[model samples]
Target: MNFDEFTGTVQHRLELPGTGEAVRATRATLTTLGERIQAGEATDLAGPLPMEVDFYLTGAVAEHGQRFDWNEFLDRVAEREGQTAPDDRADVAHHARTVVAVAAEAIPAGQLDQVRDQLPADEGWGNLFELVEADGAQAE
Candidate 1:
């Protein structure tokens, strides 16, 4: 998908106010994800994405493969999303899932799996893939 289409899909999925919110959601989720996973894996995941959106994975990562658990991942994403309230974590997680689901659709098959492999399933990191997993089940 192109940049507009990708952001539009995310906007629709998250029911955000506009493209700007969608962009922010995408940025927040992917950038945080980029930080959590290895740099090479992040680059691989970003490969099929729109260049505009892919930069969230590429441009913002200061250290790839940084070890962080799911809660820390959500915290960073929430901060990037400007959701300061402690109660906003649920919403932040939902937003991240939505963005990831949209991204799973955009990238080639198996690419997301590589990204998934980088995160530990035992640490609740699998929660981020809930939507993607559901979608896969439905497709099957």
Candidate 2:
């Protein structure tokens, strides 16, 4: 998908007020994800995405494979998203999941799976993929 379509879909999925919010959501989620996974993997995942959007995955961070857990992941995303309230974590997670689901559709086949492999499922990080998993199941 192109930049406009990608952000539009994210806005529609999250019911956000506008494309700006969608862009922020996408950036917050992908940037955090880029930090958590390896640099090479992040580059590969960014490959099929729109250049505007892919930068969130590759260019935003100074380094990758930082080895943070799910809570830290959410914290970084919340910080980037300007969600300061402690109570906003659930909403943050939901927004991240929505962004990632949209990204899963945009990236090439198996790219998300590679990203998934880097995150530990037992650590509750796998929850990020809930929407993607549901979509895949429905497709099957």
Candidate 3:
């Protein structure tokens, strides 16, 4: 998807207030999610995404092997999103879920699956896959 289409999808999914909010949410999630998964897998996932998004997910990272669970995932998102307030974490996570759901549309399923597999299931990051569900239930 193009950048506008991407932002539109994320805004619609999250019922976000505006395109600006959607942009920030998208970037925050893409960057944070990139950090959560293996660098190689993230690069594969970024291959089919838009240039704007690809950079967000794969820019300047010499390594992307760090692993963290849901909480840390949200924390990183909040930091990237500039939502420094403690209460902003929940909001960041909520937006991040929508961002991932929207990202699912752009990423090839196989590459997306690779991302799912790369997340340490035991650490709870595997829950990221549920962000886009057939029944419309997102990762919690």
lDDT scores of the candidates, listed in order: 0.88, 0.88, 0.75
| 1-140: candidate 1 lDDT, tens digit per residue | 79999899989988888989999999999999998888889998888889998999988888888999999999999999999798989999999998898888877777888788878889998899999988872111
Point out the worst 10-residue segment of candidate 1 by lDDT: 131-140
Instruction: Summarize candidate 2's per-residue lDDT along 53-89 as a digit string, tens digits.
Output: 9899999988899988899999999999999698999
Residue lDDT tens for model 3, 1-140: 68889888888888878999888888888887877677778788787778888888899454587766788888878887889898787688778767777777766556666777767668756455566765343212
TM-score of 3: 0.85
lDDT of model number 2: 0.88
Error of 1 at 37 (Å): 0.8
Candidate 2: pairs in clash: none
At residue 116, what lDDT does model 2 achieve?
90
TM-score of each: 0.94, 0.94, 0.85
Comparing 1 with 3 on lDDT, the higher-scoring candidate is: 1
lDDT of 2 at 35: 91
